[model samples]
Target chain A: MKKNRIFNTITLLSASVIVFIVLAALLFTGIIDEYNGQLLTLAGIYIIVSLSLNLITGFTGQLSLGQAGFMSIGAYSSAIAMMNFHLPLVVSIIIGGLVTAVFGLLIGFPTLRLRGDYLAITTLGFGEIIRVIMVNLETYTGGAAGLKGIPSFSDTGDFLKDSIIKFSWVYVFVIITIVIVNNLINSSPGRAIVSIREDEIAANSMGINVSYYKIFSFTMSAFLAGIGGALYAVYFGYLNPVMFWFLTSVNFVVIVVLGGMGSITGTILAGVGFTYIQEWLRFFKDFRLVIFGLALIIVMLFWPRGLMGTNEFSIVKFVRKYIRKEHEGGSSKPSKIKGVK
Target chain B: MSVMEAKSISIVFGGLKAVTNFDLKLGKGELVGLIGPNGAGKTTVFNMLTGVYSPTSGDIVLNTSREGHNYKSIIKLKPYQITQSGVARTFQNIRLFKDLSVLDNVRIAFHFNVKYNALQGILRTTAFYNEEDEITEKARDLLKIFNLQDKEKELAKNLPYGEQRKLEITRALATNPKVLLLDEPAAGMNPQETHDLMNLISFIRNKFDLTILLIEHDMSLVMGICERIVVLDYGQTIAVGTPEQISKDPKVIKAYLGEGV
Candidate 1:
């Protein structure tokens, strides 16, 4: 059994790496093109933040409506690091995540004590407060007028190389984020977090630190959201207070809800799927929100548990089932024919 | 030799004296029963012992170790800390993590024993896998003992009613606690299941060397397995004796009924 587990792990990792290399090769070769690369990077960044939200809301069972606030903090912090201090782009991105993590801890400690709707409202208020602060801090942040002429991934001067470079950064971060989230959910600390969401009282009596795990999940989520924000800043080379609005926060939550809560694979699919759908719906111009709203309502009405319903998409399981069916085909077919006769 | 002791513990909710001057001493490897009419503070005493509710007066001193030494006042400690200090409980309503698998339920309860940090867990360090593998091995052993090994991968809520109750006990025992508090363990079982549960309780008590405090309305099972019976009435200890002595006590009769009989 242990050998099988090790084999499965190796296969999964190698498969993911191979797929990444193939895609990166395509991007570098210019076959994916700049426009499609931009779209994929956007989808990748959104997945990072959605995974962050999933860590808190889906796994930890805490409703947080202030994720966009953390994202904005990352965006501004990383932008300042790169433009002002001339720090390396990597360091600046990390700085964004670290600074935003501090804020996550600050807000999480006070707000995590509240549960359900109260926590949601507190987070919503916190996001608005961050946006307000960004709008007011005109000198440091460039305020509501927006920060422009920021350093982007176009350092190589060659358009093809630059697009690949930026896409690689996003893709690498996406893989890193996925690994961290996946590993965290399958471990002991992850079990503790989920148990808190299951039954706080039962979790407590069973010797799980409910509050500490809640804060831990919250902080991890904030860090990831910050990373997503940093990626956004470098990708667009521009920022505005209007960009990280309440509606932006709602978009991520909608993806999480459309995916199954607590299903990591489901959230990734929904994040990437919803991003493309939104981009396509841009033809509707200003009424895109109406379309999104209707889509959400219809989805919830049809499948309230979301796409996966807490069941993960496992390639190994599907392949095994398919193989077993093929092996049983001869005997099963004869039995079915005999019964029919 | 008492693993857990409550010295004149009392708790009040608003103006009502929910449980007044209650006391209990659970000896090593002994099974005790707490019985009372509905709302007679049986569960309130449980709440006080488990650190769910702070006693308005008195102290709850737990041994805090497996060797029946290192007694400490657990009254001021948080519920999780008290649990770590060697007490574990199962809820009356069977609070299993419904969405999680049966094996996952037991493994989660074993979380207190996990020594790896979050970074190690995320990194999949050797130490993390070692501890996690140990937990899985132990959890499987526990489920096998409860005869639910076949359904370990099934969601907890999908289990039959009797098995769900068994799974709850299985989860509590996974903590490897010195003291186990069962809140109405036999609340919703048939005679056969309750009989099996009675045997299971006694079997585990001996196997784990555990001191048990069970609150139950099942008279036969309680009288059959418990070494001592503590009867409560209106937030007070009305009687404390063997099953034979408790059955013949007039105060207990008065509490269970109205008057002359």
Candidate 2:
């Protein structure tokens, strides 16, 4: 057992090192230029938010339509800290997440008692309320005019270095978010959370605290969304209340549903895919949104359960299956081989 | 000593009284059956005892063997808290977590007892692995008892109906309850299945040293295994005695067979 553990650790470390080197090579060589880097950074930010939202809606079976509200809290607070309190960038981002978590607990506690549609409506209202409050807080938030000239990643005055720094924060965070979310889903508390999604009353009778998990996931989700927001704020070097509107919140819900609610790999795929598609469709001008809408409808029509439908796509499992098949069926036709999962 | 007792519990919803002045005592290692016709509030009584509904006017005291903690007032407590107080129950409809694996359904019952917090869980700490592996072992042991060890990987919803019912019981036992309340375990079972389930219930009552309160419409099941039977009609207790006495009671007969007969 100890030998296997050590081997696994070695494999993971080497894999991480290889991925980091490859990504750095791409960025430094200007193979992934400024525009693509910016788009990828945005996609990574969205992926983090989607993963967090999955913790609440997919695993815990709670409908929350106010993710963008948490994001706005993170952005504004982080921006405020950088400009007003003169904190370092990382510390500001942490403040953003912590502040959003506090709001998550406060809002999630009372509203979570109302299940199903009631919770959805309450969260929808919450998203709008946060946006309206941002518009009115003229002093700190800059109200309707928005907060501008926030610290940018381009501190070295070189465009490539700026994009690299931004993408690095996003890449590291995307990895962190994935690790944490996957770890949570595989553990004991994760079982309790998923059990609640399966059947609340049954989970309760089986000694799982239904409400506590609901609140915990909501807070955890809000914290991650805030981190995404902080990243967004730094990427653009600006904070805008208009960016975190009701539509923004609903957009994430759409991504989560389209990605396959509980499937982490699907969310990452959809987040990056949609971001790339939207950015690349700039040639269509106003027609881009129509294409986007058509794509969503087509995907849903074909795969009603969304892209992955609670099934994860694991690269290791895929690789191992083919390797084992080759050893067992050496003379078998390659044409006879089927998709593993 | 009684493991759990409901002292004249009553609950009213607006103008209607769902359960009226209901009293039950579950002595240690006793297997008691609650029998009633449809709409007689048998489930309501179970609901009240499990803290799904707080009695409008009564107290439910559950005694625990844990040192220094003799009894807990389960009245007005959340359902999970009631389970934590050593009372676990299975539903009439076999409410297993359908999407989860059969093993997970049982493991979830061990949630309250796990010492590691969410941070430890997310961090993959040593304590988390120790507790998680222990839970998996314990849940597998429970599955072995129900002969569900082979089907542990199958989704709970994909299991055969009889196995699903058994899985529900296994899950309840995983909570380590002193008192186990089973609502209609034989609802959809065939005669052979029902017979096997009754034997299983008796086996667990002995193995786990449990006090069981069961609700069933199956007369033979009630009379064959139950040491005592409580009969209810129209939200009121019509009879309470051994199966022989309950079988002879005029009130129970009237409730089951009706006035013309």
Candidate 3:
């Protein structure tokens, strides 16, 4: 018991150290300064998109290849809101998410009833349909040229005195999105999602409305992707129809798989990790697709369950087990410290 | 009125007619047995009653409240909705979330009743934790009832065969159904385990105030515990009566107990 408690404590402390070191390196070294505000926004947007993809394909065990299409809906909706209705930035983004969520529901209602491969094909078709519509709708979406001169929504930073208080709005947005997704994946609904993924037949017998939960997972995932798209549009100050391509959706899928399916931490880590890799390996741009494909295949072959697999780390369970074991066999002599026995 | 009534139900699987004009009724706290030979459609009848397969022509009416104010036509409801209307069922084969812990297996079945918002869950709000605690307490109490409290953390797949079957029943009971269905629950049990299962079923029925309908091939187990018995042969009801009447029926004797006859 004593050994287990000490081991758990050490694990937690090491995790905290790793998190602290990474965050400090990102903020203190000004490594992200190289990217323009637009690139940063796109990165943030991909963070939401990739995380949402992880929630569906990773946690829910439902394959989806239509994220790019959902993101396009958000991009076009926000662009139209700003260009036509002249709405504020926040309202437009919210509306964008709502519109995309509705579209998600429309597609999910029918396709979610089918099995994994069928759902994947249906989503892939949906993504292609959205792109085709964008190319055809020259009036609102700018056709081939796409919408331009969109106003910038967020800026880089504002420093105070000796202390460096960097509020990169892009990073802040990404952090908040990550936190929300993290919390959701760890909550009751998250458990439901994971349960459905693990065994649909068992989930149904347990009285979990399988269809309802599946649709909800799909809609929520698309909603986040839409938000990411809107953020990208606003940050970049421009938009184009070509941006929302089928390859973009595939990229998100690769990100989820590489990071580890059904893992919030792994998704975030992979998102940033791949983004840096993509940039660093830009010289070998032709090898980008090759390396990404190989990585996915290798990971699946070696660890078919992904990096974290199905085991979620729980600090509280570890702590309780440790404390119970320590008290089980230890000496029962009264201690000198206050309230000790 | 009976708590559950299945009137003139028929189910056909590609002209095979798996169940033909099958009828079963259950009053509160009644434990009924359905027995038949191989391919006798005892499970088909259970499936029709549970809404897993809708009848070709019939109706299932469930009295959801003591006053009957919340009555529903379960024939029109989906399987999950039927569960919410106070009907739960087990499978012929043990179907469990094999990867999940035993406690989670039960708690997940309690999802329909546990009230908390997605927002509250994401925020880890007080209501979330409170509801979680309540669910844990109730699940633990249920485990204690089945003497499975010590194995709460173990995965469902790691449990012994009898324990796995018990866990499946525990999961079904977690839904708090007014009527529970069991399919071939004693398929692989020894005599000792069979006796224990019989006692557990009786104890659970009285404790939960549940009306149970069980399909089993074990004639002795069925005759021992069931208050009433229904016999089926080739998707048709051959007899329905007490143990004595069923044991003596010539048609049932010909269909299932030819050696004795």
Query: Model 3 misses residue A301 by how many Å?
Result: 1.9
Q: Which candidate is the best by lDDT?
A: 1
lDDT tens digits, residue span A187-267, model 3: 567667778987876677667888888888888888888888887777666777678788889989877877678766566
- In order, candidate lDDTs are 0.86, 0.85, 0.77
Judged by whole-model lDDT over C-alpha atoms, candidate 3 comes out at 0.77
**Per-candidate iRMSD:** 5.0, 4.4, 4.2
The TM-score that candidate 1 achieves is 0.94
Q: Candidate 2 overall Cα lDDT vs. reference?
A: 0.85
lDDT of 1 by residue, A281-309 (tens): 99999889799889989999998999977
Error of 2 at B119 (Å): 0.7
Model 3: CAPRI class: acceptable
After superposition, candidate 3 runs with Cα above 4 Å error: A1-44, A83-86, A153-167, A313-341, B67-72, B257-261
DockQ sort, best first: 2, 1, 3
Candidate 3 residue pairs that clash:
none
TM-score for all predictions?
0.94, 0.94, 0.86
TM-score of chain B of each: 0.97, 0.97, 0.96
